[model samples]
Target chain A: MSLSDAPGPRWRPAPLLPRDEEREVSLHFVVAVLCFLACLMAVGGVSADRAARGWARDLRGEATIQVRPRLGETGDEAAARAAEAVAGVRGVTEAAALEKQKAEALLEPWLGKAVLQDLPIPHLVTVRLDRAHPATATDLKKALDRAGVDADVDDHARWLKDVERSAGVVRWAVAILFSLTAAAAAAVIAFATRAGMAARRDVVEVLHLTGAKDAFIANLFQLRFARLAAVSGVFGAGAAAAVTALIELVGGGQGFTPALPLTWMDLLTVSPCPLVAATVAALSARLTTLRLLRGTL
Target chain B: MSRQPTPRAAAAYGAEEAFDPTTGPVVRFQNVGMRYGRAPEVLKDVGFTLPVGSFHFLTGPSGAGKSSLLKLIYLANRASRGTVQLFGHDVERVARADLPYLRRRIGVVFQEYRLLDHLPAFDNVALPLRIAGRKPQTYRDDIAELLTWVGLGHKMQAMPATLSGGEKQRLAIARAVVTQPELLLADEPTGNIDPEMSLKILRLFVELNRMGTTVLIATHDQDLVGRAGMPVLHLNEGRLSRKATRRAPEPAAPDYGPELGPEYEPEPDEPELGYDLGDEEGEA
Candidate 1:
């Protein structure tokens, strides 16, 4: 609490303590670390989801054409026929098909040890569109079905939907992390304010006997804690920025380069986390101090 | 303005203005009653008013409501069924914001000294000024001189727990008078001190009164009161009475001067101690 009575001339006011109180510092450090980790996870998940959504947007309304396993016993002629069949199909302007080996490699990332490589993975053809050839995905699928080859058309929309839903979970986790940081700040502020109140019990009584109103007394503590929280918050935010920078710098050259670095704008958005934490601390301290002072002194 | 103090008028209009603006009593009480919660009353029909700038002794047995009455005057407790005006404003009607100013004008010496045990005597004395927002640097010299006057100059840096009872009482008095408040209330201020110290304290009150501060001392020590030749308000079983004022007899001077010692011998003019309430009639 500010000692408002002290004349300004001779009084050298002490700044209220920052979060550097050993316990407070440690607590902030923990919250900072948690926030940092959460930010990284959130940023990473967001990047992956963005990339997936981009792929989905590009693939929507398109069908892939694959031609292989013709009834006749030659693969090359079947591939040649597959190209012609797709070009002639309504709604298909062009076709660039996947080589069999390439499809096996795509499956290799998840399926493992494919003995079927020699047996021929299917020849997958992706059909491109000419803007005015008005044929729906259903019409294309029916055309591929009539072809002698075991051909299939994939719209890719359902796959995108699944990826989008999974990304939603990551976003939810980020939201929860934000809430947890706030709750932690409030808890720490309450604990610290209570300790301060206990230590200053006699001082409080003297103030009361001197006819100080409860609001005046409560304001002193509230303002003190506000200063403490603000200072801590500024430092915490600075530290978070520094750590996030280091993370981006170090995580940059690694194999797991964050799918994409958080843009300057995104980083700027996160910059206020420390301020929010501090505000939570200040408000919690004020509320706790007022509540306990009301009940006791 | 020249009217003699009426206990009722004094209570209705506080003691601060009861005296002639030039020469009236400083405090007056009339039918002042106090109770705690739903329990029975602690003080009943208390009535008296001290003359302007006069020193008086309040004597009653333990539990006789002496402290409660002092509390009412000091604005610590309110009267349950009567008015207690201070400086001419009814205390009950006084704004909360203004209470501090009123309290600031009245000095109180508690029996316990109520020293902020953590602070040294110098700081303790400076508390009033500090709370009032006076800079420590500004009042530091004034406090030092007062502490020295009370013979506590050497112990200025000492804590309350370390000081002897006499030293503590002196410190309490120094704190009470530092502001030169209009009224001073002492509740057995000398209870823990030696007779020599008691007389020294009594002399301090007399000196303060001479300087025009109104003082009311509550103590059961009749010998102390009689020797001082001050009027006494004796309280018994929730009732109050005023004993006649008598002048000291042709006297031998009691040496109450500053010699640090244990016993205080009475002057020949001093009346015999006669305020034993234990032998009084049954309580009402």
Candidate 2:
């Protein structure tokens, strides 16, 4: 009789592997953690590199002159003289004297605002060296001495080197963190896939005897893991993003923002984290299952 | 390429006709040997041929490799030595992609029933059809009727754990035959059922054999083998011996005791018992 003639209950076979609710939830948690760590590392690395470059660009080919108030000269008068002397130098491009208020503000972080007004703060002059005829700190100091200005020349080379080195170390640390997180994630998935295969060995044998192709059986696992990774990766990335946004929000009020501001592009770079995670999970599952099936079945 | 036999072709080729080996045996093995990893060979120098549309019983002791021999026949295990062939194709030479199709033509009823516990009886029996990519709407009625014929009509929605041993065996048998495979292999199919149910299950195999499907049953049940009166392939300590054919007795009417209720019918139509070959041809 034709099937249409019999109105029976319609049914579909349960998948060879059940949803594995507990295992999957645990896997999601792991993948999410890995994704969060990887994304945070990536953001941290990019921000550090940008900050280093900004600091270098700001300090490169520049020198600062500090003129103390003489016995009878006011601080402003000495700063004016130092600025004029530095600007007159052959290799100097421009020189600007810091006002009393600006100088006080620079010291505000170390000393209280009102108290800094009573102290004898050195008047500061910033000198930009000409690119075509760069001047050394020694040459600038000698030129200032010859101009009868009592000032000290600082090239900021030591500070710039330290900043760049620290930034490099931070970048490397971030990269190492990323690598470790990825490795840990892969290891976790591989272990879980192996456990899953062991748990479902009987099912695998039955499917094999019943004519299921290796690819079909592998896909059943690969697809599930890929989906899990993708979903968890998103959750982890989202959590990381929220945490970063909070840092930015909290740090903004205190005027302690990073040298290079975080941009939407930074977040966009981390957006593909989920896809990468899914790919890694799928490949790991596929390879593991195929190898196991070949050896055992 | 060899084409799968259509329903019309199957109808034309009666099961009672003797198989002509000259055309080639449906299954052939030469000096086949098998072992698990570094373990000793469980099956050694086993040679046999199962002709098209033939029925035979494999009899052996518990450790005599009956299941192992069946595994070799169904492509579940490869022989360490010698060659094996199924359906005119060298098993080793068959492309991996083509293995599934080859497997689709062979149905196996495992000893444990191996029903997915999460699925109901209806879904369990429909597994072969689903593996063959047949949609539910197309085979729903056929499956329901097959279950009903196996006396499992009322237990269609019951889980494997809920079904009795006889019911599970019946479900497994129904699953094996649902695809109407060209070859049906059963490993101790009647091991757990009562004598009456065993006879009934044997009749189902007989009906399937009449429809041009080769049947091989691996079991140690001598009474069942003797009652069926088919040729027997005996295995002892990895060695095989063939028993000469015996004249088959006429099938007696099954006595459905009062407990069986009206569910036990006298007989089902032969055409209904046979799979609609149209589905096979459609697959082509």
Best candidate per TM-score, number?
Answer: 2
The TM-score of predicted model 1 comes to 0.64
RMSD per prediction, one decimal?
Answer: 9.5, 9.2
Model 2 lDDT tens row, B84-188 = 777766676655556666677788998888887777888778777766667778888888889888888878878899999889999999989988887899999
lDDT per residue for candidate 2 within A150-260, as digits (tens), equals: 888889888889988988898889888888888888878888888998887776776777777788789888887888899999998898888777766666743226564
Span of ten consecutive residues with least summed lDDT in model 2 chain B: B275-284
**lDDT value, candidate 2, whole model:** 0.76
Return the top candidate by lDDT: 2
Ten-residue stretch with the least lDDT total in model 2 chain A: A1-10
State the TM-score, rounded to 2 decimals, of chain A in model 1. 0.69
Model 1: how far residue A100 lies from native, Å: 4.4
Cα deviation of A283 in candidate 2 (Å)? 2.0
Q: Which residue pairs in candidate 2 have backbone atoms (N, alpha carbon, C) closer than 3 angstroms, thus clashing?
A: none
